[model samples]
Target: MTNNVVIPSRCWCGKGILTYVSKTEENPYRRFFRCEIGLKKKKEQHLFKWVDEALLDEIQRMHE
Candidate 1:
């Protein structure tokens, strides 16, 4: 999905994006972006992206 990666500022539901650190053992302290509303609701699909991956994608795009 490299071609589709983009930094998201807003969710499809119009809510603001929020950055949060992962608490899971698999990715402790890893930062990610998610839709604020979806994070609370937990029943619908929403925007979720890894900050590092997004930045990498952006950098790759710049080089390209």
Candidate 2:
């Protein structure tokens, strides 16, 4: 999928985004943005983006 990262300010559910570090073995210590409500209800569509990917998108935008 194309990178549409833009440092999301909010989720479609109208809640503020939260930054959290991953504690799983697959993605240990990786930071990501997520909607608080989505964390409670795992089986729902919500905003979730990687901090590093978002920053990379920002840098790419600057060059373009």
TM-score of each model, paired residue for residue: 0.89, 0.90
Best by lDDT: 2
Instruction: Pick out the ten consecutive residues of candidate 1 with the lowest summed lDDT.
Output: 1-10
Question: What lDDT would candidate 2 get against the real structure?
Answer: 0.92
Local distance difference test, candidate 1: 0.89
Give the clashing pairs for model 1: none
Model 2: per-residue lDDT, tens digit, 13-61?
9999999999999999999999999999999999999999898888888
lDDT of each structure?
0.89, 0.92
What does candidate 2 score in Cα RMSD to the true structure?
A: 1.7
lDDT tens string, model 1, 1-64?
Answer: 3657489999988999999999999999999999998888888999999999999988888888
Give the Cα-based TM-score of candidate 1 against the true structure: 0.89
